[model samples]
Target: MQAVLRAACRAAADLLFPRNCVHCAGPVETGSYQYLCPACTRALQFCEPPACKTCGYPYFGSVIAPRECPHCAELEPVFDKGKTLFLAKGPGRSLLHALKYHQGFYILKDLTRMLKETPHFKEFLSGAILVPVPLHPTKLRERGFNQSEHLAHTLLQNSDARAVEPLLLRSEFTHSQTHLDRKDRLQNVKNAFALSATANLMNDTYYILVDDVFTTGSTLNACARTLRTAGVTHLRAVAIGHG
Candidate 1:
């Protein structure tokens, strides 16, 4: 009875102030939480075809071959495989910025919706424990919350998958690698992570490390290296976007 009453109150409130779409800023007639108008959502370049099988990065034109991109082929990723919901263009970029910089927690629902409905990622979740890449303590303090953690939780909650936050730790705070080249980025984060001493990882367990974006992939590689060393046999990853 209380739950029904609360839902009724929320419905009435939504009727009073219909939520606007996040992408187009138009009135949502259905009083829903979707941030994009249907038309705008269609206009966005959803990562459909020509996507790399290993990382799910949408490739334009005819050039790349199977199982890899120029980026991933040159140097293999530490993680065994990866996939993404969107190709990190159009509304993808804007929504990610909102989630990271503007505290757009509401985007979690939309992001998770995309993840859950993607057929490529649906049954591929077996043996996968969702793990969010960790932010350094200082960065976490400044940001007030880890955006990657929010994304990971969304994946877990929507997919009914087990999520573990205790498997990785930032051993020491390192300088941000936003401006660094790939080599320097890798070096900057070297020795920056350690497997939690209390982590009870089974040798056969598979983990899917989550993050907001995949740039140089140096950070995820480091985390995957640590997990591999800790006896984890199968590792996969997914990011909100692939830069």
Candidate 2:
């Protein structure tokens, strides 16, 4: 009865104030998602097996013989493995843009739903400690909220993760990596992260690093290096999007 009432209330509210699709900016009249309309939701791509173990970008074409993943070929991973929810293009890019740049906390529900439906991603987070790649104090102040931290919390809420820990702290306020090449990116984030005081390194516990996007894997590697130096043994990573 309560569920029916809530549904009816939501229907009435939506009727009064229709939502625009995050990707296409079209009216979201009918869809499984609240933010993404039916067309854009269908455009969203989910990552599956035959993906790169280092960065979780899906492989195209033949899978019998493995080929190098273009995304993380330059990334020397300090963590064990990695996974992502989707390819960061098309609808995926718009979703992240809204969240990271446009102050779209409403997008969290959609992301959480994606995480739940992506079985491998949910399974990867099981029984692990989720570590968000922290923003530097300056960056945090500017952004107002850390998307990585939010993503870590999302993982914790839906998975059997032990907890969300801000174990790695960004010490250096480096410029954005959006335009930096792999070599420049590697240099930019080098030694930019350090372990926080609360980072209780347990050799037995699996620690999964959470980030919003895996563009070059440089930031994630740096965070993993910090944790590894602090004595974390079982380390891996997961990102919401992989470009």
Top-lDDT structure, candidate number: 2
**Any idea what lDDT model 2 has?**
0.89
Tell me the whole-model lDDT of each prediction, alpha carbons only.
Answer: 0.76, 0.89
Model 2 misses residue 208 by how many Å?
0.5
Best by TM-score: 2
Candidate 1 lDDT (Cα, 0 to 1): 0.76
Off by over 4 Å in 1: 1-12, 24-26, 30-33, 60-68
Tell me the number of clashing residue pairs for each predicted model. Answer: 1, 0
Task: Please give the distance, in angstroms, between residue 87's alpha carbon in candidate 1 and its true position after superposition.
Answer: 2.1
- For model 1, how does the per-residue alpha-carbon lDDT over 102-221 read when each residue is reduced to its tens digit? 899988877766765675665556547888888878888999998988888777776746665657888889887878988898888878889877888876667888888877778888
Q: Write the per-residue lDDT of candidate 2 for residues 82-168, one digit (tens) a residue.
A: 998898999999988899999998899988778767888898889999999999999899989999998889889988899998888
Estimated TM-score per prediction?
0.84, 0.97
Query: What alpha-carbon RMSD in Å does predicted model 2 have with respect to the real structure?
Result: 1.1
State in Å the error of residue 76, model 2: 1.5
